[model samples]
Target: MVRHMDERAGVDPRRTDELWLRESERYASTHPRCLQLRERARAHMPHGVPMSWMASYFAHPPVWIDEGHGAHFTCADGIRFLDTNVGDKSTFCGIDPEPVVRAVQRRVAAGSQFMLPTRDALVVAEELARRWKLPSWQFTLSASQANTEAIRLARHATGRRKVLTFTGNYGGHGDEMLTAFAGEGRLSYLGLTPAADRDIDVIGFNDVGALERVLAAGDHACVFTEPALTNEGVVLPEPGFHDALRELTRASGTILLLDETHTLICAPGGLAEKWRLEPDAVVVGKAVGGGLPLGAYGMTAELCEAFERGESLTGRPGELATGGTLFANALSMAAARAALTEVLTPDAYKHASALGAELADRLEAVVAEAGLPWKVQRLGPRSGISFGGRLARNAAEADADEQPELNALLRLCLANRGVWEAISTAGPALSVAATRADVAAYVAAFREFVTDVTGTG
Candidate 1:
């Protein structure tokens, strides 16, 4: 059963409320410039921010970043922060990485887009193929678009309209991918048509029995999943989970699509490569373009050949729905190529991994010292503290373990101390450019927060 905040041991609601109040005041005092900018922005944008999600995701008024260099960024208030959030993994290669910046500058001077593929496109595609082991590749502006296209292709290829996705799976915000399980039925998020849940099935992340039962019908075109659930929290797959997943999908003739946009932090080639899991196709994005917008999907040779021939598994010819005018534009292609080749190299991953391990260790130590019932979970260079005694095995447990008030207070405290982390839904991620100093700074700030909250100083 899920435990409420007040029901959890070692956490006092009144103390949490008091700390939240203190942190909120501290945040307001230190962020006057951000407040001023937000007030000005409110005249045009909702909640005084360009994006609706950004408006309420932060603990205080949204910080206006003047510039970012490597693992740090200066807010409008002139305070520099160790940016563990890394633009929510969009800038995982680090802010303004030199290689990507140089490549983007050159590409911009040459013309950003031409509705034509540049030589960099070939280089980027070839690199993606080499990393993910897929022979044919395509590009999109975001992972959401890539997932949408992948689903469409899967439906076309298999002549099946049903899509299977695990609970807490966040590939993208595409319509069909947005539905979640609600009791015996499923419900689509707001703004989505009722038909969004038409043929989509939602199951638990590591439930082999549920998986077997669902795929038994052989009606699903594809089973889209992440190697490990990251968005809800880092829910690692149980032993034999991946094996069962791959085997079931194959026997059922369902297209197995692995979305590694976030899991790429797991290794140079992402979890798909790290675990040697076989999939019909792979989708990646986020850090792929450094700080630019880019998404890519790769397919096996057989899938590509069948797609090119416009033939489904049953040899039915159909009109293909893919490609966009601005897709694979020159600027994005150049950024992706430089990011993969020059910025996010093997050495870079090694550096981030070392710091990530240290950060996780320090966080665990702090939690233990505080006598809190929290557990720290790590996935390569990413680590998150779950407000539970043990690691979550599925999305439901992760959701049950969430402590929103505590998290908000923690984030506000960290921001006031010159450390920035991702939103409540995300954990801290060390970028390729992060240094040991950055990790140390984060640990120090976190320790202070824990001491204040637990009164253990």
Candidate 2:
């Protein structure tokens, strides 16, 4: 039986395919410059992009962006697009935020990096501690690195060899956190050995029973999770889920590590602060540096003390568990200082959250007017339309709710009409620089797409 039968029946797949064909033709005709660039790029780079994933992630050919200002960007074709994706939330503060730009400029002129720490590192760490309520902090080049280091620290502090994660959770690209549960066994991704799976366990989100069962083993180092499942389309935790998770992990002597990298969109302090979560450690990245490459992990003072007493992997005494040559570089620290103090302020979050709510409401109304069995799921300044009428409770249901053909058609339609939505797996999000006008533009394009797909016009 099809789980999303109502959604499937509302819009005929045959009509969707036909409209997709039309949009594909329109995209090809209108984006000649992007096409030419792709051809030229293919001669030097694989799949016409520096990153292989970028080559086929979009419904239409990837548009070459010339520049971005506040809430919009111009493509190589001289067309401006309302940037709802915001670099997949990497530029959540908005493109070229003045304070960050000025800070970066000064840092570059002075010096970009040194193995030594700078005053900005102290300032950034202080700000992060203040916001997250964690005393000790460390930096890395990306959230993936932060997560990796956090896992190692957890292992060191607890003398455990295993890790725990929830289903549909993305805790960076690290090998240890990348596997998911398959039946009674684990499913490791390519390039990962079965050895990595031996120490990892995956369970469904919001399943307190499963979490308790796994943590009871008493050999797990940490339970890594987001405040909510953002990458799998904003699957929020049920009421009291976090409370149970914390209680269970605490009782079992397992560390609770929350990755707030994407969930930073939830608020200035991310969901940890917004929800008053008391995680032992928190990981953050992406927009925290105003789009510069910066990631940080903060630990409670107790955990910090434990980590200090712990030995390094090489059996060195009194050495910290993690450090990188370029970690805490001057440039990243400068940008983070500016971003936290000036760009991602309370007022900016207020504006972005308002715009996010407005976009979700408008899209929901559009679906209702079109009489489609779809709904918009929102998290803070982020929102995405799920094809199913009800929200998904777990990863399996979320995966089942996916309508690839419909998603691709919607993305291509929005792209052709000058709104750049997020990639297929993610959703549109408002940046701090977004305005009502941008939200309206996105709604207009989305409404048109609905009309075309459902023949509701």
Q: Give the alpha-carbon lDDT of every model.
A: 0.86, 0.86
Q: Which ten residues in a row have the lowest lDDT in candidate 2?
A: 1-10
Top TM-score model = 1
What value of lDDT does candidate 1 attain over all alpha carbons? 0.86
Q: In candidate 2, what are the lDDT values of residues 208-286, reduced to their tens digit? A: 9999888888989899989998877889999999999999999999999999999987788889989999999999999
- Please give the clash total of every predicted structure, in order: 0, 0
- TM-scores, each model vs. reference: 0.96, 0.95
Best by lDDT: 2
True lDDT of residue 392, candidate 1: 89
Span of ten consecutive residues with least summed lDDT in model 1:
180-189
Segments in model 2 whose C-alpha atoms lie over 4 Å from true places: 1-9, 181-188, 310-321
